[model samples]
Target: MTEGKRAIIQQLLQEYDIQDAQDIQDALKDLLGGTIKEMMESEMDQHLGYEKSERTESEDADRNYRNGYKSKRVNSSYGSMDIDVPQDRHSSFEPKVVKKRQKDISDIDQKIISMYAKGMTTKQISETIDDIYGFEASEGFISDVTDKILPQIEEWQERPLSAVYPIVFIDAIHFSVRDDGVIRKLAAYVVLGINSDGRKEVLSLVIGENESSKYWLSVLNSLKNRGVQDILILCSDGLSGIKEAIQTAFPKTEQQRCIVHMVRNTLKYVANKDMKAFAKDLKTIYTASDEKTALSQLDRVTDKWDGQYPYAMKRWHENWDAISPIFKFSKDVRTAFYTTNAIESLNSTLRRLNRQRSVFPSSQALLKALYLATFEATKKWTSPIRNWGKVRGELSIMYPDRMPD
Candidate 1:
């Protein structure tokens, strides 16, 4: 078989008047077109219970026989090639390799979909394909390719999840989307979970009108309905009502407000001259040896800067309850959940991809864009979390009941 294939290829190479790579490629396309046509003819012969030239009388006289070939122009990256597909009298023969009405013999749709998933715009994808291959793929064709993933995304959104997640980082990335013919800011809420094996997975993603506790509640409830029984640590930026939402969904889950977000919110009130000193003093509260020491450092921070920026102090005090949970875990485990950095990194990638798209045409368009960006971003999450062995050991001790064997 190998020798036969090599002989056929050698014969094809000899038949082409080789001048450059393009000429060789054209010859190869012709070879493939002929090969495919022959395969379909063989398929028809097998269906009719006889060879192409042999005239045989079978038991079933009503059985369909091979009819003349129907030419089909197939679009491919190699170039436009025509295949003569075999037909039957009853039109019942189905070829497995190239089905009927399948104009894309080269799987160009998958290529377009792959490009779209890599954050390429429809126009960019079309141009890229045209530049590489002498084929015309319109923006609508690109969109249709991407639309095929929507059902897969929908099924993924509704799929069942692990019963428990050791730590979950929830954050929202804002984008401009059109709704009801009006452009508005929309939030894409992402739930990044650390599973038992210490791998990060995007458990759920939901697009909402705005980032609010009310919307987060629905997201959390959706997780609950999808079989997320317990989340030991829920980390998020200091969004109002998130604590209440967590309480309602998983009352036992410990909430850790991102210290980085708190510092940024507090820094808004501090003057430039005092910003460095203020941030230094504020770090003492979150980076202290223990919770009591952190609380004492918090008092000192309030005393030193409260008169100048009372609201900043008030904001810290108001959020202290949510922020204090991080102190309970070991430093190794706490490092993973003390801030929303994990989700923020994902958001940063999304911002880079979407910077060109100022306002999406619709909410569905924005969702599709985000889903594609995320699908591409998560492809690199192959390695396990850094020092996960040590972190998981610490987490096991902290949340013994929730830890898996």
Candidate 2:
């Protein structure tokens, strides 16, 4: 270090009587408090157009001047410190360094918001702030800080989407929230889309009273209003009335039922001893090279298992139209759209974050937590899906009129 700077440090050490780390922190806090006090005094002098105890020739009789000092305690990284804020007779002098009514001087508000986004409870966040920054942050204070993102969440939910999406996945994650002292289950519908460039994007998220095709219809209508004119393929679990909703919103869009969900549903009725063999036979139907071969395998599996599990075979026949679309695509495209794993993986992340809070105070609170977690989870979606080049080529051929150049 330079000799001049080194001397200044030596003088400060002597003046503060520094001995250890705690002493150094106390000394720095005092210095910071004094520096803020001096800055505010300078600001007051500039506002009054004269230095303290000095008179200017052009000063008027009714000019504004410093009245007295107001004691205020502010929290900072160096711990909490008290400051004597200068006041004016007219109350027109605003301090830029520490704005009026802003108690926490450090970036503690952002820290609280970050913690809240990671599914930390307000009480936990408050304790964390106290442990790390040596200050007590109330739960109410943390909630107020996180509420600042409500507008941002609304903007993101309403933002316009691309005119066309090559593929979209729709799914729901359930949460419990309090409504008039009664805890009820609610659904958060997540709509994820793959744009023409083949990148994954979370299009929208909304909280509904329950998981229903009616609520999904409204969500789809909102997407249509936002600018989604065409979606080549939409994949989802076999929820009742969802097909009708899709047909109503975008009649031309092809629907692909989630093969994983179908498998799970079929296996639900099969005996545990037979599940492995049953699943193996079921895989043959979906893994076939073409639709004709898949249908033949379906017939074979039906003949083998129908006597024991007729309902399982019945579900396949009932939903054959929705389940057979993947057979028309090549391996790469089929792999991408055959299941709802992309969106389900997203839901799993949300669920992991949501586990900390068993019941939220309200729907808005639940949405805020989810929005923050979703934002954090989606940060890694910086690139397109794997083998997107070939997938896009197949989509282009599949939907020539809809695919953008």
Q: What TM-score, over all chains together, does every model reach?
A: 0.90, 0.94
Q: List, residue by residue over 277-394, the lDDT tens digit for candidate 1.
A: 9999988888887899989999998998888888888877877888898787666667788888766668888887567677777777677777877888888888777778888888
Q: Across residues 317-361, which tens digit of lDDT does each residue of candidate 2 receive? A: 888999998887887779898887777667888897658888888
lDDT of 1 at 90: 96
Local error of candidate 1 at 306, Å? Answer: 3.3
How badly does each model clash, as a count of residue pairs?
A: 0, 0
Residue 310's C-alpha lDDT in candidate 2?
Answer: 84
Segments in model 2 whose C-alpha atoms lie over 4 Å from true places: 1-8
Instruction: Give residue 5's error in model 1 in angstroms.
Output: 8.1
lDDT of each: 0.83, 0.88
